[model samples]
Target chain A: MARASLREDIVNAAVEQFHMFGFTAAGVKDITDAAGAPKGSFYNHFESKEALAVIALERYGATRGLAALGDTSVPPLARLRWHFEALRDENLAYGFSRGCLIGDLATEIADHSEVVRKAVQDSMQQWCDALSGTIAEAQQAGEVTKALEADTIARFVLSAWEGALVSARSDKSAKSFEAFFTVVFGVVLR
Target chain B: MARASLREDIVNAAVEQFHMFGFTAAGVKDITDAAGAPKGSFYNHFESKEALAVIALERYGATRGLAALGDTSVPPLARLRWHFEALRDENLAYGFSRGCLIGDLATEIADHSEVVRKAVQDSMQQWCDALSGTIAEAQQAGEVTKALEADTIARFVLSAWEGALVSARSDKSAKSFEAFFTVVFGVVLR
Candidate 1:
């Protein structure tokens, strides 16, 4: 493969492993093995494991945001639900063995590593911004109630969604995801 | 100090360092130094670092939950607010340098280590149960609305609180905590 494609492959593989096992636990060997790249190529592409994390986070953020945004054919509310549903399905497919990459990284490295922390933070903000913008559109379309501002609603939705993920990982069930959707979406649509 | 007291001190100190740093980043030396115990004594009290983490999590969970529960003089709603307020104060005091130990460990080890994952999950559930019971009491007393079920409300509250911590750590601001509380409490009360 080309150098750029090989580099991208490494990040994508690393992101998956990081989501499943966190940055520290998921080593360079695991990432390279998954990427189908030789060990030396990992070093050639990134300065170090931390550097790989930075790139992986950036790519993970962009891919997640784009995936959420690209489902444009669905209604705003359905699109929002779809975003979470996709996450839930993916989690279950993995046997609830994974959490959000950003959430995992934020918990693991936020206090200790400034570079990784910023990457995780920026990714979360981008997700929040995307959700907020969609909610704003829903507001304009009169699909959601006007009792709360979109930004505030966005924060609530995002935070609750993440909280539900934590619960899902712990409970080993997607029930938290379902309940979160039921309550928040129920309130929003009402 | 007696052996039991020394063990407690070691676990307490370990809790602080683990919360400020993380599992992999916080070393045995840090914990021993913080505890003012001999470095060699770490293995004496606990089988390994992982063993000590389980003890520390249990202690941290009990200490934090009891501290929150002991404030019976405050109204239930205010009691919940006080808990978050304390968290806000902690974040500010520590320069937004730490999130909850359980939260950090859940993210870091949930996928990789079943022992740590269960400890973190159990602690979170206990916290959620306590908060939920408090909210239910508040509803019965007409201190808060019954618009949503107490369990659902409690989950949302806890989740938002944890998510806010992550945001606060990332942004290096207590504003996220304040904003989250304002929005969540405002919504619940309304």
Candidate 2:
């Protein structure tokens, strides 16, 4: 229906603005204006900004997960590498204009917004879980270190990747990503 | 003497507000109110909110560096562990309400504010340099692996710690910090 499409538009706009300006700085008016939707349409779709943020976080997590899972035909380690490369390209395309949306929101609202905080927590856990699966497969394939437990190594890899993203954002350079990926995966492969 | 004290108070207040509400959401009024300084006094001391932020960031970095250095009387590896433990306790005491001020500001303003972005980059590089020195000392003392260069390990440690903070903030738990430190350092020592 047209109404549902409008709602999706509003949520997408909110996610982009919220990622750029953060939850407190990005107002409902700004989201509506960016979406080209009437103000009433925003309220009609979501009860409040907090409610809207919760939905936006979910959408973002789902979309990113699907994109990262692209072409399962590739070997798990190579697929994982592809995912990081895609992320690097996306960050560069944006001119390093934003770090991860989940990261930004987690830092900004984690202490205050319980709903938003849970959404971020869930997204990160899900990411760790997905990476864990790939790592387990790699271990079985003898493509990665078998000495470390799969789950533990997965968590380490995820944490290192997130940290590299933060460094990349701060420096406005993708070199951090390159260095991190090389060192982390290099150790496993060796 | 009074002028120096007032300026320090303003910078401290701005750092607190920025940590709580981020760069864009935090305003001059919020910082001035927190400092108990008059509005005119704020403008007389700083040209703009961005100017105040830069000074506050420098103060924050210096304080954090001193805290991280601690006593330095213990063994090299032990000293490094203690530094992380101190950071863990600080986060727990704050109820994880605050993350690294530099990390928070870098995430929020790096994309949009060139001055703030460069300040964060410079501060992070300084932090990396400091940590690299410690790692080099530890390696020379046979406290860690020499297979990886000290600077590479330094980058890994710093990035992992930052990521652990993000995970801690999201999960509302310090377990991520503990897990990351144990695994990364465990591997290094082995």
Candidate 3:
């Protein structure tokens, strides 16, 4: 159990380090130091930094509040909006310094590392699948247009949100998020 | 003239290096080595890697074929689609290995370097401005809905494209581009 705790600590620190310094810039030593573990022990916990990033990406996805989309108490569209709203609020809380780790990895590391790329692909696919279910519910409820497939719309919406987060990070403002809310909800979903 | 060529070569190589390896992963020595220039000459051409990144970003923006968005010969909406198609084809040509450098930088370096962040902001702003102009023309031609401001729609479209590129890179597929075309044209602009 103590060993498992150490492993958990390394992953927690890795998520933050990768989010802050990116995959290549944030060395294993940095992650170990942040986790308060000895540098040599990093190898015992994970095969390599790339392997740890896969774990980190999964951890990040679990915290994305995807469960909100599955809540039966709220209208589907509202649940969808709340899900993105929560994501936007979190990014804003970081002052736009930390965009989505999945997105960050997708842009920076996906090209070079097949392992990380597959992890990102899986993470986004899981998110899109959840969103597709909610969007289908909204379509059935007559709350959203059925002009497009739920899966297609979900993918595009997720992509737009990812892009908006990148813009928000670059501009250091929430204007992109507002635009996302406007067009995604007002125009696309309408 | 020879000296000027060396300076230009460093900028060109920096663009490719950054696109492939990202900002933090690609060192100054790597960029200089790729340019076939001496590592020691790197300081003579640029003040810092961040400074070189700004220039590299500008060079990258120039290659994005934004001029196609302004060709008066084509209908404004067609021009807009063609602009994105060109970008998509370029990414396909690279086998989904290289995405838009601006987006790559925005996600990876924007938070860490204000100089690179400003450069990314300017590049996206310029692209958005051009897209806004094209979208406005489409609105005036009664091809696109005028319910939303042209600038807002332009920003949203650009963000969607950026996100799609990230997805395309991660998935190693063109499905996101197809989704972008379908939604951005079929739904949002409709």
Candidate chain B TM-scores, in order: 0.88, 0.92, 0.97
Q: How accurate is candidate 1 locally (lDDT)?
A: 0.77
Interface root-mean-square deviation, candidate 2: 1.6
- Taking all chains together, the TM-score of candidate 3 against the true structure is 0.98
Instruction: Give one digit per residue, the lDDT tens place, for model 3 in B10-125.
Output: 99899989988888889999998999999999998789999999998888899887888888889999999889888989999999887889988988888889999999999999
Q: Write the per-residue lDDT of candidate 1 for residues B28-109, one digit (tens) a residue.
A: 9999999988999888778988888888889888766546643667788887777777767867898887777877777676
Stronger candidate by DockQ (1 vs 3): 3
Candidate 2 residue runs with Cα over 4 Å from true position: A1-4, A66-73, A188-190, B1-4, B66-73
DockQ for every prediction shown: 0.53, 0.62, 0.84
Ordered from best to worst TM-score, the candidate numbers read 3, 2, 1
Task: Quantify all predictions' global Cα lDDT against the true fold.
Answer: 0.77, 0.79, 0.91
Interface RMSD of 3: 0.8
**Chain A TM per candidate, in order of listing:** 0.87, 0.90, 0.97
Which tens-of-lDDT digit does each residue in A1-190 have in candidate 3? 3465888999999999999988888898899999988898888879988999999999999999888899989999999999999999999899988899998898888888889999999999999999999999999999999989999999999999999998898899888888999999997776
Most TM-score-accurate candidate: 3
The candidate with the higher TM-score, 2 or 3, is 3
Q: Could you tell me which 10 consecutive residues in candidate 1 chain B have the lowest summed lDDT?
A: B63-72
